[model samples]
Target: MKKIFFARPYRFIFFPLAAAAFLSLISFIVMHLWNYLLPGLLHVDMITFWQAMALFVLCKILFGFGGRGKFGGGAPCMRQKMEERLKHMSPEEQQRFKEQFSNRMCHKSGHWGRRDWFGEEAKQEDKKAD
Candidate 1:
């Protein structure tokens, strides 16, 4: 009645085989790239296929498996809740809310751009340091 890539028994067999093949291919690429780049560029030793797989796993653990975008970038429902709250606020309240949000997010110094947190005070500090 329904068309599927693999039937019941084949599904179990096919998925694991596919996953293993994918992992193997990825590890092979990682091994080749590390051998090609890092050994000469960073003077790191060339890694084997198993080592590359381990490195991939280690990176996945250290960073993440990849999901959200950035810090404080919450889920869609959270965004909707924020928008609903903002809609209820007055002009002054909205401005205050925006300022608070900016402060918490990437609007301050050490974030992205050259804009300092203390504005001119940070420039003076930098001059003193220099």
Candidate 2:
């Protein structure tokens, strides 16, 4: 028993167990608060309150603990395709592509600095265009 508990393979069990315990605790606390609030605010009964709590827990389990593609297959093929595409690009084209991709990513991510949005060169170009 001690050896089994200390094994590396058993370490994986701890993660899901801890996660489930934490999620259950959160669900219980949230349901308790909702029960307290709903009875005073809207005159709900204990049965209805418990039913809502069960539904909430069910939804949480379905959405949170459900199997997602992140843990499944097909990721390797997608990564291989991306690597192959990158390997096929010329050095200059790759540099340009990387610059444009980073710029678009930065802008779309909404973490732009002062110069990131519109710099002196961009302003000059805008003025020239006008």
How high is each candidate's TM-score?
Answer: 0.48, 0.36
The local distance difference test score of model 1 is: 0.80
lDDT of 1 by residue, 56-120 (tens): 88998998877666655568799999899999999998897777566645554653454544456
Candidate 2 wrong stretches, greater than 4 Å? 1-7, 47-53, 61-130
Candidate 2: C-alpha lDDT: 0.66
Where is model 1 more than 4 Å wrong at Cα?
A: 1-7, 69-130
The TM-score leader among the candidates is: 1
Worst 10 residues of 2 by lDDT: 110-119
Clashes of each: 0, 0
